[model samples]
Target: MKIAIASGKGGTGKTTLATNLASYLSEEKQIILADLDVEEPNSGLFIRAEKIFQEDRYKMIPGWVENDCTYCGICQEVCNFNAIINLGTHILVYPELCHSCYACSELCPTAALPMQKQKMGVLKHYKKGNIDFVESRLDIGQEQAVPRIAQTLDYINSISDNKEIILLDSPPGTSCPVIEATKDADKVILVTEPTPFGLHDLGLAVETMQKMNKDFTVVLNRFGVGNADVEDYCKKNNIRIIAMIPDSRQVAELYSRGELVYDKVDSFKQSLDSIKHYILGK
Candidate 1:
């Protein structure tokens, strides 16, 4: 099963849940752990595996060829991302704003638009016994992460068979990045805290998932430290909160030290098993 552990906002313990599940599930299952939170991928920091391979990822952006006669704003008009800007005398193309749909280049009346491969991020591969680890890290100052996340998912899916479980650690927010990361996932684990902001963003994320027709549920983090407002919202929406991780200083310290909670506490592993059972409907 391909499962994406995602959150509506940041600091909701997605990396914590994803890394632990990947580590624990590897004991008996052949799994691929994909960290698609390219903007800030800290899951790799917690994976504790040797790096096997790495590659720089690139995306095609619109490049001016300077062969055109007409200064028409057709390119700018056709481009929805505003990557191509027409100043009447000179048309400027911003690579950062480019989504690389090739619409500006394809529909250019003067055919003066070319393509440039902009370095977006890096893709890394690693392995630890039975588990295969992959992560995408977006370069600083880059706005586009959806493409890199898609490539990461595609890479894992291409190599993995049906028996292998793909666990995706997604970026926070209900944007294109999260959707790209979890679009093809068989299931999605929405991680959230019990605070007001958490509940609000979780609702946005659920609506996004529902619109996409994806199977998803909540994994409540910071259970005791905050109110049960999140639980009430879930129950009202008919959303199932399968598991919860309490707000413990011990767990926090262990996380800060880059140690697995299950290795230090027995109950942590049981909690993971409970999550697994819920996913498998056992």
Candidate 2:
């Protein structure tokens, strides 16, 4: 099963759930944890993986052949992202805004556009204990994470196949990068807290998951932080609360020390085991 742990907003313990779940499952079965949060990946911090390999993740961006150019605005006009702009005599390309779709190059009327590969990020693979950790780190100042995520997912496909389970740690928010990370996932575990903000974002995340036609369940982290608002929202939306991790100062301290929750709390291991059975229909 390809399980993706995601949240609509940041600081919702998505990575906590993903890393711990992989750690727990790895004890009994071979699993690969693919951290698709390329912009701010932190799974490696929690799981001590031995660096096995690394590769550069690249994307195609529009390159102007200045000599072959007819100073036409077609390339700029066709680019919906405003990645390319034609000023009277010069055409500029903004690599940050570019999605690397190559549309500008394809529609260049004068054929002055050529696609050039740009390094966007690095895909690193590591193995610690029994689990395999794969993380993609986007270069600073890089605004495009979808391509990096796609490249990471492709790397996961190339390395993993029909494994007992594959846990994907996705980026926060219901944006393009998040969508790309969660797309085609067999199941998604939405992690949230029991607060008003958590309830609101959970609804948006549920909507996003439904739109993507993915099966998902909610895992309420810091369950007693606020009130029953999260539970109420899930009840109204017909979403199942598979598990809950109560708020604990020790948990917070362990997290800050880069320790997995289940490793810190023995009881949490049972909860994760139950969640695994719930997901596997056991």
lDDT of 1 by residue, 1-282 (tens): 899999998999999999999888888888899998888888878888988988889999877776663877789999888878888778898888888889988888778887778788999999998889998898999988888988888788777887888899999999898889888899999999999999899989999999999989998987787798999999998999888877788888989988778777666777788898986678
Name the top TM-score candidate: 2
- Stretches off by above 4 angstroms in model 1 are 67-73, 86-90
TM-score for all models, in order of appearance: 0.92, 0.94
- Residue 19, candidate 2: how far off, in angstroms? 1.0
lDDT of 2 by residue, 1-282 (tens): 788999997998988888898888888888899999988899889988799999888888888889888887888888889888889689899988887777788888777888988888899999987788999999998888888888888888888877658899999999898899999689899999988899889889999999998899999888777999889888987898898887888878888999999976866676687788876788
Task: Please list all clashing residue pairs in model 2, or write none if there are none.
Answer: none
List the global CA lDDT of all models.
Answer: 0.87, 0.87
Whole-model lDDT for model 2 versus the true structure? 0.87
